[model samples]
Target: MAYLTLFLTAFAAATLLPAYSEVMLGAMVTQDYSLWWLWFWATAGNTLGSVVNGVIGRQVDRFKEKRWFPVTEEQLEKARNRFNRYGQWSLLLGWMPLGGDALTLIGGVMRVPWLNFVVLVAIGKGVRYGFVLWLVLNTAGVPSESVPSP
Candidate 1:
C-alpha cells in the first residue's frame, strides 16, 4: 500500500504536475519502509512520468501550428538542432528546474532514439531519487522503534 502511494506520487511529480515525490519518499523512509522497494517504485514511477513528457514533446510539432501551445516552428527547429548537438548528454541534466521538461520534450520532438532517451532519463532520475534516499537514511534518523536491532 505504501509502495503504491509512493509510486503514484512520484509518477505524478515527474510530469508537469505540481507534485513533489521527495516528501512522499521522506515519509516512507521515516516510516521504515523497505529501502529497495521504495527506491525501485519511486524510480519506475518517475521514469514513466518523464516518458509521458517525451510523448507530449513528440506531438509538439503538430501543435506548433495551433498557436495555443505557443511553440513556433523556428523554436522547434532550434530545439532540434540543440538536441542534435548535445545528443544524449542533455538528459543527464534532466533534474534541473528550468530545462528538464524542455529537454525531455525536445528529445522526443527531435526523435531521439527511444532506448537512448529512456536510459539517459532513467539514469538522471535514478540519481536524483538516490540522493533523496540517502538523505532519508542518514540525516533524518529513523525512529528508534522502527529501527530493528542490529
Candidate 2:
C-alpha cells in the first residue's frame, strides 16, 4: 500500500497536474521503507505519466481548430522551434519541474520514436528519483539498511 501511494504520487507529479512525490519519498525514507522498491515504483510511475503527456501531445493537432484549444499556433511554433534546436537530447532534462512536461509533449509533437521517448524519459526520471532517495537517506541519516542497492 505504501508503494502504491508513492507510485501514484510520482505518476501525478510527472504530469501537468501539481504533485510532490519528492516529499512523499523523503517522508517514506524516514520511515525506512525498502529503498530499491521505492525507487523502482517511483521511476516507473513517473515515466508512465510522462508517456501519457506525450500521447496527449500527439493528438493535440487534431484539436487545434477547436474553440477550447489550449495553445496558440504562435506559442506552439515557438515551442517546436526550441525543441527542434535541442532535439531529442532535451528529453534528458524532463525531470525538471517547470518545463519538463512541455519537453515530453514536444517530443510527441516532433514525432519522437516511442522507444527513444520511453528510454530517455525513464532514464531521466529514474535518476531524479534516485537523487531524491539519496538526498533523503543522507540528509535524514537513514540507517545503512535503508540504503541497500536498487
Which candidate has the highest TM-score of all? 2
At residue 17, candidate 1 shows an lDDT of 86
The estimated TM-scores of all candidates read: 0.88, 0.93
Model 1 — TM-score against the truth? 0.88
Clashing pairs in 1: none
Error of 2 at 5 (Å): 0.9
Tens-place lDDT per residue, model 2, 53-143, is: 8998899899888889989999999999999998998998999998999999999888899999999999999999999977877778777
Which 10 consecutive residues of model 2 have the lowest summed lDDT? 141-150
